[model samples]
Target: MRNAPLGIFDSGVGGLTVVRAVQQLLPSEDIVYLGDTARVPYGSKSPETIRQFAHEDVRFLLDRGVKTVVVACNTATAHALPSLQERYQVPIIGVIEPGVEAVLADPQAQRVGIIATRGTVRSHAYQHALALRRTGLILHATPAPLLVPLVEEDWLDHPSTHAALHTYLDPMLDRGIDTLLLACTHYPLLVPVLSKFLPDGVRLVDSATTCAEHVKQELTKLDLLAEEEKAGKLEIHLTDLSDQFEDLSRRFLARSPGRIMRVSL
Candidate 1:
């Protein structure tokens, strides 16, 4: 089982951030990534529908003989993680707990700000998880529904993207948040632009990096870490092939996403 590929799924290409992180940290572990692009934007779906979609996504990955599964979509992690965990024997990890851990990792982190999609913010998954872990920790979660489309459009440095960031994040900054948690997988791509505006004292916690670290730790404990001497391979599967898949995959993965295949659930 240790030699089997790791499974990761998201509503779209955003989960490639997690894949990139794993590739950097665990270079020997092969990966199987599924992007449910046919029915993307799971952030807008009902909880019941999200759970159902998540089940099917997991089934597809399991069919490929993955050692463990990572729920890379924030909305799906929020709505479907527990149930998925209950149904599957594989060690299923979600982005929310890892994100909360990253925020709490800073001993001085108080007044944390979270920016995610409408479904994730509405679910209060990060908020609730943080509250359980730390007392007297203040959290403000804002739903930035516009940023996803901006990211998909590859507007990483466009003026409109910068304007949207300011519009969404200025209020949190004004409230004196000590740390800003990028709760969604796509938000990490905005780090350069975010750094241009954020104060030096404010910390940025990226869920993608944190989740990757957490996966490393968990794999170590589970004795699932692959041999370090061997190089890893990445395979990307999308439910629908969009015209922008190649470009967006490169943007998200920071390299050519080799041989992307389209599959139906």
Candidate 2:
């Protein structure tokens, strides 16, 4: 089981952020990634639909012989993780808890800001997770529904993206937040753009790095860490493929993801 590939899935290519982190941390562990691009942006979908899609994605990965599953989409993690865990025998991990853990890691945090997709904000997963660990947290949660589309469109540094950031952040800034958590995996890609607008003292926490570390810890605990002396391979599967996806994925993974294949769930 230790040599079996780790499975990770997302609504779309945004989950590549998690894959990148995993690569850097567990270079010797092979990974299989599934992107439900045909139904991208699970953010606004109904919870039932998101759950169904997540299950299909998981089934696809499990069929590929993955030992563990990582729910790399914030919306799916928020909505489907519990049920997914109950149904699957393999260990499953989600992005929400790791992101909340990142926020609490900062001892000085008092007022926190969360910017995520509509479904994640609606789910209130981050708020609930944080409340369990800390009290009297002044949280500013907002749904940046447009941000995901902006990212998918490859507008990382476009003036429109900057405007959208400003429009979404101005309200949070008013509440005097000291730490901002990028609640969605895709938001990490906007860090460079987001940092430009944040106050000097405010910190940004994103799940990619923390989640990778969390997965490493889980693998260690389960004695599933790969003992191979060479680097691992990454296989990317998508529900749909396009030139735009190919280009964006290259940017996110920091290298070509080998041969990209399309599969139906």
Local distance difference test, per candidate? 0.94, 0.91
Error of 1 at 81 (Å): 0.6
lDDT of 1 by residue, 1-265 (tens): 9999999999999999999999999999999999999999999899999999999999999999999999999999999999999999999999999999889989999899999999999999999999999999988899998898899888889989989888888999999999999999999998898888799899999999999999999999999998566989899999999669888999999998989999999
* Runs of candidate 2 exceeding 4 Å displacement: none
Each model's total of backbone clashes: 0, 0
Q: List the residue pairs that clash in candidate 2.
A: none
lDDT of candidate 2 over 119-212, digit per residue (tens): 9999999999898899988988999988988887889999999899889998889889999999888888888877887889999998888789
| Model 1 lDDT, residue 220, Cα | 98
Candidate achieving the largest lDDT: 1
TM-score of each: 0.98, 0.97
- Model 1: CA > 4 A from native: none
